[model samples]
Target chain A: MWKEWPLVAFTIAGQMAVGFFLVAGFPLFLLDGSHAVGTTREEGLAVLAVVLGLLVAAALLSFFHIHHPLRARSSLVNIRTSWLSREIFFELVFIALVAVEIVLVWGVSAASGLSRGVHVAAALAGILFLLSMIRLYMLETLPLWNQAYTPLSFALTALSLGAIAAGFIWGGIFILLSLAFVAAEIVISFLLAPGHGVYRSRPTPSLRPPADVPRYLHPARLASSLAGLSLLGAALIWGRGRAVEGLNGKEWLVAAFALVLAGQLTGRFLFYGLLARPGR
Target chain B: MVTQYGFFFDAAACSGCKACQMACKDRNDLEPGVLWRRVYEVAGGGWEKKGEVWVPSVVAYNVSMACNHCEKPVCGLSCPTKAIWKREDGIVFVDTDACIGCRYCEWACPYTALRFDARTNTVSKCDFCFEAIDAGGAPACVASCPRRALDFGDLAELRKKYGDVRQIFPLPDPSQTEPALVIKPHRDAARAAERAAEVANWEEV
Candidate 1:
């Protein structure tokens, strides 16, 4: 149970941090016809700092899962061949690029126009950071994580969260995009679900008795069901309102978060429970 | 004084620019995806109320890393084919020609730095830019970094420069391996605890 918590916590923290940064940082990138508003260069950079900091925190936390944390540095030696090494390498590079942007924003006296380029660079770095994170889970040995859609799913999740947060902050076309992403996530989740027939063997009966079986499956199944329902809710809200108003954005965000949390937890549980052990 | 090569990474001054990465790639003529060095951005602390002041302090530390080339290297110890070796200068190298493409060294290294080249069927890693160091030029990365975040010189000098300061924080866990690289963490006790908790959670799989 303790072991599972770490994975759960890390996933939650990572997703939340991505959401926080996206919401905090997107307003800076928004152009108002010919002008931009709502974010200063310093604030934009502070958001970058927060995002990079969170990613580093996530990376450092990942080290604990490894048997040897001290030798973690040795992982970098394999950039020539391993995607794992490349992932670490790119994460480091992305962090560095953000640092450069921060320095240029805070330390140097740069023009706002120059700062726009930095924003674009920061966006590119964010993309790299997300890609590196997805690649980290793409080990061929881990069948559940190794699927082609694993990275795609993760990327979509991040983008969905980011778009939702962006919609809340920016409140325009971003809302539509966020709703579309939510709808897409619902379709993906439904497609990805393993039906009862898909199981390689029968599920072990709950030793606690039949009464406990529903209790165990309730959260997972309900969460899965809620994911689809919430997505439909989001589509309805968007179609009727056209433009997000009142609490619409917040409702969509809350719904998306719930669905994603439920889906991810269910997926993680299934990954650990059903996947064949390497030796077995 | 006997001369030895190592890195002098100023944690305080490092802004985590990846020019070092680019420079290393250019100097080594590596393919697009290859990187001999990496920079890690480490941060700590959270918002806490100290009296009337709601202090939300966060500090960023940059770790520009490469092969630590420890006095004792596990990669060398675990390589069944004797492909990995340590030099007198405290640099670790992989003899590609002698490598059997077995990934044992990759698992042996805690740093995950040993890469198995499928095309060459060999293992490879940083050689500390031997040709440039031999010519008295700084390693390509050290020379190219605009911020001077990385400096390569005698290990003793680096120790002396940083010795008086508080020992670096969160040096990789010391149980399974001893890394030559030293880290100077920016955060204090509370932050360390938070980070430790975070790490504990991440290991779950």
Candidate 2:
């Protein structure tokens, strides 16, 4: 399972990228059809570039999950029946739409007016991409991942990370949402996940370790989650105490992003660790 | 006209010597970790008190399994590259040429029929010995069983001969993939669930 690290990185990075875009870009669409904001158009372009870069990097990393990279092109051949194929299809579309939106708004003239439409389209594609990613794991055969927890955890990761990234600009509302998501994730994983373990059920059991195995939850994963939430909470308090200033929250947000990202990576690692055959 | 072939297992007659598994591995030349057909040793139940005596209530049996080549194979449906496909005779085959080695089919198959081949960086499984079947010969596993505990034929005929029981303890529900196999269950199977029986030999399979 640890060998599948590339997949863990791919999914978390891709989800964070989408979350950042949705949280940071939505306000641009809401601000009365004007491009004016505290940050320069160049800065907005930089943010979009960051999101695009993360997604592209994620796509590249996912290639490592396949043993034969040359045959990766054929992954989309079964979109009709395969969630994996649909996931790749939607991810590519999301990336393309984001690229075009960036070009229209930043590379070309802002007077083109095509940027907003493209941004909206890109967001829609991102939503679909996220959905496909969630559905890919909600397989009936593996009851552990087939629950509401998979989708919920993924969505929460996006929301929390995105909110923290945009928290200073949006004030305490985004920060509050981030905390709420984090708290909910902790509650569910600790409280509700035990009953789902494989040894506990027959036909609808959760994914678990093989026989005579020890340790239900990995210590590293739990530690990472604690560390991440602590960093985010510290950032929240720091931002709340400081007077609003341009780029003041930027540094803290970056710190929060790095720590949260670490937490997400470890969490995803544990998620893959749950992969086990039912009988033995 | 979609002719389906299947295997029939008489668990009552099996002796758990693993001849079928060895025969399959030998015929397919499987590597150390890759097994197309596996025999699971199911054992459970502890000491029980029966009024005036303490009695051992252990129940044990062996289930020899391979790809059932189900009617609605989740492995094929979940393959992103369409690498796993079913023949006209309902035998599932992995197109190693097209497989990207994502191992999603391995996760999707409840029977865990698919096994990774590190040498090829792809997955392979039982093809129902299609080459021998086409030539009117028994599969190596079937022919090798000295006790004649295993049989193979058309799904309809196997059902007629063996009755409709397709699942035993630790085996998943048959409705998931509509596997074409049939079984004459061991006597211990009825009490397996109550006794908390599970597949015991994990390292070998």
Candidate 3:
């Protein structure tokens, strides 16, 4: 299970990139409308560049998960039926769209108007990429990952981390959004807590009883998440208290991002741990 | 019409010697950690009190298994590169030439049929000894069984010869892949779940 670190990095990094991009781009979509390059355009382009960098890193990390990285081009061969194929396809599409958006918005003056449409398309692609990632693990054979927890957890990872990353940039308002995502995460955690280790129902005939999801990992994930939640709460209070000369709340948001990202890393590890090695 | 190939297992007769498993390893020249076939030792129950004294109430049996070359073949369906494919005679083959070595099929298969070959950096599994079958011979594992515990043939023929007992204790549900296999379950299997039986041999397989 620990050998799956590459995959862990790939999924988490990709999700965080998407989350950051979506959350940061929200202000642009809401605050601007005209074809003219707004004051925040440079900052927005810089943020998009960061998102692209994260995606490229994710794509590179994923190559290490497979043995023959050179043969990765063929991975999309079965897109008609395979979720794995669809996932790679969507991720590439998201990356390409983001890169194109950056180039068109900054380099080509004539193509400036197409930037919003491209951002929207890229966000949609990011969502599809995440959905495909979820679907890839929803194997009925593996009851541990097939549960509703997979999709819900993945989506929340994007929202929570994205909101926090956005808060790091957009500052004041996004802290509230981050808080909402974290709250939703806590609610879902509570909902899934009851069936943490037990496989009460047999979805299909399993060769052996479904191995229990690690009891130890859950507490660690919960602790980190709750700790991050507390920090975000503090950050909110700190922002309000330190609201002097145009405070964007970058001070506390960075720490919250680290804590939440660490929590997500632990959770992703636990997710892969569900497929215990030397499987029964 | 596609002639789906399959396997038949006689849990009652297996002695847990692991000859079939060894035979497969020898024939395929599998890597150190790779196994094409395996013998599972199912054990459960502890000392139970009788009228006067404690008696050993262990329900133990051995099951030798290989890929069943299923009808649905989830491994192939989930393969990103479409490297794993089924033949006309229902034999599933992994086209290593095309495989990207992602190993997603490894998780997709419930029977744990596929194993990663570190040497090839690709997934490998039992192919029903298609070459030997073409030359009018049995699979290495089936032929190597000392007690005639394993059998192989067309799925329909195997079902007709043996009863349609596809599921047994510690074997996955047949509906998942509709595995082309039949079995003669050990007597203790019916009570395995109630007796809290489990596949005890993890290190070997």
Candidate 4:
């Protein structure tokens, strides 16, 4: 399952990118809202660059998942039926729109209506990309992935990661969302996930055993990751009130973001490790 | 009318001998760890108490399977590069030239039919021996079956020759892909699911 690192990176990075865009770009629509305070054009552009850069890195990593990188261009041929094709199409569209919006904002001005329009367009494309990505894995044959939890967890990952990365604290809304998502992910991992059946107290007799137990699935490591995430969420919420002398609020926020992102990365690794093949 | 080819397996007659499996590997020249055809040994249950005596309630059977070349092939529908496709003969074929070896179709297929070919850096699977079929010969698997438990012909002809049952224990529900293959189920098949019977062999194909 570790062999599927490319997929794990691709999905997480892409979803985080989408979430960052949505949270960071929301202020473009609020013409006279004070809640958009501290939401500057430069910060937004930086986040956009990060999202695009992550997406490009994700695309490159996906090439590693395939044996023939030279034939990667042909992956877009089956848009009529394949979710994978739609995913690529929407990702490209999202990237292109984001790039154009960046040029408009940087070359023109942040207050330009045209850049806002492009931002909205990119957001729509990002949503499509996320949907396509979800559908790509919700295959009926693979009982392990064909569930509502897949999309729900992915969406939550986006919301939580994106919220913090975009610096949208929202009077502790981001922290609460992050905690809630972490809890939901824990619940899903133990209960709703198809692969969770393997670790059941009385596992049903199946063709194959739980393929491999990765380090992240170890009880100790799982608990530690969850605890780390909870502490990070608390720190983000508490650190906002107690300002360190040298460390600015943004620095603390960045630290929280890095920790949470690493936790999510480990969670994704465990997700891929649960190999539940149909027959054998 | 398009001639949709298919296979018919007499599960009652099969003796678990892997001649068909070997014939297929030999015909395809598959490398180690790659199996185009596999025979699944379904085993489950144990001794059960029947009043005053312990009865052997155990059940076992074998299912030799390859690609069914289903009418609605999920592998074909799921291939991002249009690498997997079905001919008018209903034989599903993989285009190594187009396949990037992403192996998404491997997950999509219920049969576990697709195997990664390390040598070619692509996915490979049973092609139903279309070349031999075009030359008016049966597939190597069918021709080599010692018990004559396997047969191949047009889908309509196979359906007429055998009953309409297409699914057995450990095999997925046929509705997903509408697999063209037909089967004469083993006597223990009905009880297989109830007893949590599963494919027993893991190491060998």
Query: In terms of docking quality, how is candidate 4 classified?
Result: medium
Chain B TM-scores, listed for every candidate in order, come to 0.79, 0.98, 0.96, 0.98
Q: Give one digit per residue, the lDDT tens place, for model 4 in A1-280.
A: 6777888889888989898788766554443422121256666677778888978887887888889999888999999999999999999999898888778767886666677677778889999999999898887776666776578868877876776765443324455455566666666655654443335321333223346654435454246446646665655556564323224544555665666666667666665666543322
User: Which prediction has more favorable lDDT, 1 or 2?
Assistant: 2
What's the number of clashes in each of the models?
Answer: 20, 0, 1, 0
Question: What is candidate 3's CAPRI-style docking category based on DockQ?
Answer: medium
Q: Model 1: what TM-score for its first chain? A: 0.67
Task: Give candidate 3 misplaced runs (Cα > 4 Å).
Answer: A34-39, A108-113, A190-215, A241-248, B47-57
Model 3: residue B92 alpha-carbon error in angstroms? 0.5
Instruction: Supply the global lDDT for candidate 4.
Output: 0.76
- Candidate 1 CAPRI classification by DockQ: incorrect
Model 2 Cα interface RMS deviation (Å): 3.6
Cα displacement (angstroms), candidate 2, residue B82, comes to 1.0
- A169-210: candidate 3 lDDT, tens digit per residue: 556667888888887876776678544432333333344334
TM-score of each: 0.46, 0.92, 0.92, 0.92
Candidate 2 is graded, for docking, as medium
DockQ of each: 0.01, 0.55, 0.56, 0.59
For this target, which candidate reaches the highest lDDT against the unseen true structure?
Answer: 3
List ranges where model 1 is wrong by over 4 Å. A1-30, A33-46, A103-114, A136-144, A195-259, A272-280, B1-205
- CA-based DockQ, model 2: 0.55
Q: What stretches of model 4 exceed 4 Å from their correct place? A: A29-38, A168-173, A193-210, A215-225, A241-255, A276-280
Q: Give the CA lDDT, 0 to 100, for residue A32 in model 4.
A: 43
> Candidate 3 versus the native: TM-score?
0.92
Arrange candidates by lDDT, descending. 3, 2, 4, 1
C-alpha-based local distance difference test score of model 2: 0.78
